[model samples]
Target: MNSPRLAPPTTWFRMGLHRYLGWEQAVTLAANRLSGFRPVRAVFATASRLGDGIGWYAILLGLAWHDGLVAFQPVGWMLGTALVGLLLYGAIKKLTARPRPCAVCDGIRLSVHPLDKYSFPSGHTLHAVNFSLQLTAYAPELAWLVVPFALLVAASRMVLGLHYLSDVLAGALLGGLLAMLALLAQ
Candidate 1:
């Protein structure tokens, strides 16, 4: 008997990726539904805005103030890593050209304006996680603050309809990897 024909490798990969994207879009829509509530929307919008870099910058300045000149090393690392992250994420976003959930899905509500046109990996979340990991490593005491802020920033991306779950996950993973590399270099 002849065996059934198998789909090509590229077809199989595309099918899997499409299915994953469908699931991610569903999750993004579900989270975005919560944006209808004014308070919830406000909170996430604020978080998304802060994750734009102001929060991280303030934290860096605080560290410098607290540690004086000693904060130079960690602050330098954070700045460098963040610059790399900015470049990496911008390049990947352009390469992926993934549309924001709000732009693609009918049910997804945009709670905040996106920083860039594409949304493959969340820049807000990338910076949040990067700064949180580096700060917590340098001063464990700041974990209580930075970790929750990072989590908020990540969640806000989806809830605000600026990114899909996959985008946020990719950003977190990339951020974590960058942090690890920075730590190793130190």
Candidate 2:
């Protein structure tokens, strides 16, 4: 009997991509130069929070008044993504004991406080992908916006030296799978 293949070429490719992304020279350049646009980064960060807030409001409205249309589209997407994101985050953290890039790689440094836990799957990347997937489901017309932003968030994690490329890929896959499963459940 043949043993199951674990960590295939795609996995290796992703790992290599992660290394390239986590290279200190590029990260330092982005952190020192591109990050100077504080306003833009702040806006992007706040968008994620706002998305969560919208999800909460929708849930409250749905339970209190039994109305699913309050903020309708955006809220629905937000709620769906949040549910999957939270569940997958727990699973990834428990299953993968990989450390954050900054923790394991001497070649990379973080621009912010280092996370002290497994990094095989990035929570931020998961959340971003979930949001993008949900948005795509809700509004097919916005495919162009949703796809690129999702990719950008995943890339940014590695560029920021917070997560490896493999971590982001795992996160993206898990997040997307969770969203699909949720839809099937309903």
Candidate 3:
């Protein structure tokens, strides 16, 4: 008796990848609807813009200004980790080349312009989580402020129609891992 031939990679992808991408797109579209409300759009738009780097920089500057030399070590650690995260994020984005939800999906409206052309793992979420975790490690007291802001930054990626759920999840997981590794090294 002859054994059955296995399906090719293309066939397997056609059967599974399309379905998964469809589900992701559906969820992304649903989340994008939240941007319809002016208040919601405004809030997330601001969060997304800040997540671009200004917010993190301001936090570091404020800490330094407030605490002077005491803030130097933590600030240095955060900045170093952020630089690593940016390089890794850029490499992955170039490899994946996944288009932003707003670019590919109908009914997904962008609340704010994207900083980059493609989206896979969200850079904003990655930096937010990484920075938040680093802050928590250095100054547990600041968790109350940084944690919520990190969460808002992650949510803003989807609500702003810049990323899918998987992208945000991946970013969070990667960021957390990177933070853990960096903390351990310290």
With a 3 Å backbone cut-off (N, CA, C), the pairs that clash in candidate 2 are: 18-165
Better of 1 and 2 by lDDT: 1
Which residue runs of candidate 2 sit more than 4 Å off their true CA positions?
A: 1-81, 114-116
Residue-level error in angstroms, candidate 1, position 4: 3.1
lDDT of 3: 0.90
- lDDT tens digits by residue: candidate 1, 61-85: 9899999999999999999999999
TM-score of each: 0.95, 0.59, 0.90
- Judging by TM-score, tell me the better candidate of 2 and 3: 3
Ranking by lDDT: 1, 3, 2
Q: lDDT, candidate 3, residue 2?
A: 100
lDDT at 141 for candidate 1? 99
Give per-residue CA lDDT, model 2, range 110-178, as digits (tens): 554534467777776676666666556655665686676666566656655566666777788877776
Give the lowest summed-lDDT range of ten residues in model 3.
Answer: 105-114
Arranged by TM-score, best first: 1, 3, 2
> Candidate 1: how many backbone clashes?
0
